[model samples]
Target: MSGHDLPRLGSLAWEPALDRPDLLAAPVLAALTAWAEQDERVRTQVAVAPIDPDHADTATLNAVHGLPTEASANCVVVAGRRGDDERVAAVVVRATTRADVNTRVRRLLDVRKASFLAHERAVAESGMEHGGITPLGVPAGWRVLADARVAEPGTLALIGSGVRRSKLLLPGDLLAAAPGVEVVEDLATAIDA
Candidate 1:
């Protein structure tokens, strides 16, 4: 599909992700392929577009793409341990907010403490780039917690496509309803943009 057929978001030239698997990281491609067959929204609405890897950071991306920071979502990896077992979760929040890792995340994981996963470990475990880990293809054992604000009506989530070279854009409800996603209230605290 060409840019004309893709969902319009920001100023990027969007294209159908399934038609340009090269724009997606391996796990992301696989997840999309599967979800397309299982969910109508995934097949019809998800779109991808190339981006400058150097500008993949949320602030830079929003600035370059002419999107409000609230239109973008950030995914972060967190890990906590209880005894010898560890629980890992991918928390998604609007770019203007921060995940409550110290209390909410730790409580959600039922562990005494939760911390952001090391960049290297996150990249290695998720099989995605350091700045482009997304909730869509995170390991099945890990939880995906999207802050409720992200699923509010009229929001479009600009998220990593598991690679720094491209981004995925879709309605927030699509992400909220994606398989294994849990919408949690007050999961993140808003920060000034």
Candidate 2:
């Protein structure tokens, strides 16, 4: 949506993300600026909203903002080993679905097993807060895998801005088209929620 057309959810007062670097963590701001340099649409399409860090989780964030579950995506860090080398990646899936970590991610990483990265390692390595890791600005070598469902037309998903105090709203197609993202089918399976 355009800047003026930004959706008004329950309690969030949306502002252009570029207008509030303070709301974004260092890495997130850097990534956003870089992306905007390459894609002008990024400047208008992305937005941010300040929030209580306590409401950072998807369920709580949606509840407080009157956002539907489908309006957000969750980013998870996964790591697996192949021989002596370790591979790391971030997976973005709709909040209504869970990543097929064991079947899909493991196969994609070419590892015997894949598991969630340690909380300490994820936060430290990503330069982001514990509950606010987005697929944007992950380490260069780390792959970003987004489930196809998240990138369908007309989807705008709320994502962390590398901090719990704010969030970024971005179109799913833009996320799929991001420089390092790989759009994969069946990467996640729907859950009861």
In model 1, the clashing pairs are none
Tens digits of per-residue lDDT, candidate 1, 41-136, equal: 676678899999999999898888898888889999999999999999999999889999998889999999899999999999999998899999
Candidate 2 residue pairs in backbone clash: none
Per-prediction TM-score to the true structure, in the order listed? 0.95, 0.95
Local distance difference test scores for all models = 0.89, 0.89
lDDT per residue for candidate 2 within 1-193, as digits (tens), equals: 6545554455798887888999998888888899889887777788899999999999999998898889789999999999999999999999999999999999999999999999999999999999999998898879999999989868887889999999888778877877789999999999974
TM-score of 1: 0.95
As for model 1, its CA RMSD to the true structure in angstroms is: 2.6
User: Which parts of model 1 have CA positions greater than 4 angstroms off?
Assistant: 1-6
Instruction: Give the Cα-based TM-score of candidate 2 against the true structure.
Output: 0.95
